[model samples]
Target: MSSPVLKPAAELASTNRTRHPNESADYRRARQALLVEEIELRRQIERVAELRRALPEGGEVTKAYVFEGERGQAAFAELFGDRQTLVVYSYMFGAQREQPCPMCTSFMSTWEAKLPDIEQRVAFAFVARSPIARLIAAKKARGWTRHKIYSDTAGDYTRDYVSAVDADMPGYSVFTKRGGRIRHFWSGEMGMDTADPGQDPRGAPDMDPLWTILDTTPEGRGNDWYPKLGY
Candidate 1:
């Protein structure tokens, strides 16, 4: 009349399943080594974050540069337009480049969709080291009319923010303002770590939640992804 006792998982293991003896010991050792390496990499990332948090306050802003905006043109101070902080993403699209950088294009595609929410928290804009007319023309061709765009043709602003190295290197930077003085805060020169090869030189920090959400789907953001302007 007593209830049957439950067996342990080990006892339920299938005895009939065949085991391959051809698997080399070196292969098993290599797999374990990779696992150990991954753990160490994660620790290194945490250390980098600690150092970032300890960084001292940056230099004060001294110069204002001109940039073209959605409503014609504006200056660096005007772009902030009264906001306490500004997040400028230095897009790689330029007058000389025939096509937009795929990695930057992907990030912008994600950022554009959440512009309304981002605008409420901080002033956001995209800057490029290209002529205003060129930037405008590219924006229209790509259909990114809603998101604010700007041109850093002279490279002064880009160099000041460390977003541009000379006339070739491309990057992004963020700034904060206090008592009428602006200071550099952060930046994203590298694309996301998971980004495809031949896209961007920098790797993106794992902060955005959009990637995780997209990972749940079967197609997984699909391989042939490309940014569509209006559609």
Candidate 2:
């Protein structure tokens, strides 16, 4: 049987379900217009995801990147842990910094609760420049139990995949070990350099749901506000 064709998002959005009684006609008209754009935005998100999935196979990784984790020293290949795909989040916790980047920490906090579900399909690990003990201490302090945290004590992985100068930066990278060969799949390359005017550089389909939720409010993520380490 042939698949059924779907109506355009704009057409579907035109049939908006409900409206606030207190709202003015001007508000409803503007909201309907916004709904159309929101529908287009949703479509754009799917298109981008499709393009990401269609990307060509990335370069193979030959280096035996070792990391210090709860299991002591482990090679990069061990990170996959039976999964074909591995996701490594390079945290901005370099040796010089006493604490981790608040932005990175905020994003990490969201993953803590969803790690189990996410790990079902792919291996996920967070790497930092601090020692294993320090990483553990922070993890304990933050009450992060699900994430398999690690320390890149040697700085080899950070320098190669994260920052050339080993600068404190947050990065997200995915690797795939298919057909008995491991290769770099993708990474969040956007940063300050790619940010638009009055906007912070962030990955599409943002990893953190905090921003997504705030975006739905009237006061969208403002320029002055940012996630903090503590209240």
Q: Write the per-residue lDDT of candidate 1 for residues 1-231, one digit (tens) a residue.
A: 553664432333322243357877786556456545555566568768777666687777778788766577687877776688898877776666876676566667676568888788789878887777777777776677557888876778877765335444446667788887888877654545545665423343444454546655666645566444334
Q: Which candidate ranks first by lDDT, i.e. highest?
A: 2
For model 1, the superposed segments whose C-alpha errors exceed 4 Å read 1-54, 163-167, 189-204, 207-231
Instruction: Give the whole-model CA lDDT for all candidates, comma-separated.
Output: 0.67, 0.90
The true-versus-predicted C-alpha distance at residue 187 of model 1, in Å, is: 2.5
The true-versus-predicted C-alpha distance at residue 211 of model 1, in Å, is: 6.3
**Residue 4 shift from truth in candidate 1, angstroms:** 45
Off by over 4 Å in 2: 1-6
- TM-score of each candidate structure, all chains considered together: 0.62, 0.95
Q: Candidate 2's error at 38, in angstroms?
A: 1.1
TM-score of 2: 0.95
Model 2: number of backbone collisions: 0
Q: What is candidate 2's local distance difference test score?
A: 0.90
List model 2 lDDT by residue over 74-190, tens digit each: 999999999999999998887788988898898899988799999899999999999988889888889999989999999999998999999998889999999889999999888
